[model samples]
Target: MKAYIAIKYHINLENKELIEEISNALEVNKIKSCCIIRDKEEWGRKTFSVEELMSISFKEIEISDFIVVDLSEKGVGLGIEAGYAYAKGIPIITIAKEGKDISNTLKGISKKIYTYEESSDLVNYFKRLKETSIIHNSI
Candidate 1:
């Protein structure tokens, strides 16, 4: 399975670590994950036009089994990605830090939402989901 991780382009250290943790958790479950920022770095690409980026992202979302979106911080691009994934009939797993306010529009499209105090909460949840075969069958 493959997951497209949608997150704010400009993130703090905490959010960065959270993305890393999420990636690690997905790896343990044998799920391949991708995101724009990481892909750009891996490709050694310095710049891309907005249209180019969106084209790439849309292609990635189209091929992914599901999407994992971090909504702790609001961003137009995040919403766009979630909306595109939803339109493509792809499952969305939304996550946010405890106490962060998420827009109703996002919640409406999410298959599951996790409000976590620690990143480990997400890791454990993914483990449980994999154990129950939810990730494989449902997603």
Candidate 2:
């Protein structure tokens, strides 16, 4: 099934190697994934109007069966995308570094919240998520 990964843009710009590891994990678990920052071709084009761009993004999130929100850092865009996915009836999985405080607002909307100390934590979680239907259908 298709999944959209909502992550901070800075993660892409700075720690791309880590993102690659995450991508590998997703692929190993049999999920087709897309990330806005990693897929520059999806949004790097010039001359697109704001409305058009938003529509494209919204469409992607809507098409995905589920969303994975990386709460490793504070991100306005990530929060908005996760909220949009939640509103659209898509299951959401939220993950952050151990000891980080995730807002209750986000917890209420997510099907599951994982606190990770390393990439392996996320990788293992994704592996499990793929093998079972743990999605919470309620809004």
Candidate 3:
């Protein structure tokens, strides 16, 4: 299935290990991802008009079957993407660091909510997702 990872872009850059762990896990399961967190050139420090950002967001959402929104930090942009995906009826897995205050307001709309203490936790989640066959086949 095609998936999107909605995460704190800046945090991922600072924590390369976090991105690597998640990417590797997804790769193991053969999941294709449109992960904006790593697309530095398109969404880096360079500022863009809201119209441009929204256009990219819309295209990503259109091609994705599910979204894994990492609320490790409360990212406004990620929140917007998650909300859009929720509105489109796409499945979402909202994740955060254990004890992190990810607002229930956002979690209420998610198909699943998970909290991790370590990177391995994320890998395990993906494994479980794959085992359950919840990642829908790509169109």
My TM-score estimates for the predictions, one after another, are 0.88, 0.84, 0.83
Deviating ranges (above 4 Å) for candidate 1:
11-14, 43-45, 137-139
Residue-by-residue lDDT tens digits, candidate 1, 1-139: 8999998865333456667887887788788899787776443345677899899999999999999998878889999999999998898889888999989999999888888898777778877777877556755
Q: If both were scored by lDDT, which would come out higher, candidate 1 or candidate 3? A: 1
Question: Could you list the CA RMSD of all candidates, in the order they appear?
Answer: 2.3, 2.9, 2.9
Q: Compose the digit string of candidate 3's lDDT tens values, residues 17-72.
A: 67667767677778777765455333355555678767777689877888888788
Q: lDDT of all the models against the reference?
A: 0.83, 0.75, 0.74
Off by over 4 Å in 3: 40-47, 137-139
**Off by more than 4 A, model 2:** 42-52, 136-139
Q: 2 or 3, which is superior by lDDT?
A: 2
Displacement of the residue 126 alpha carbon in candidate 1, Å:
1.0
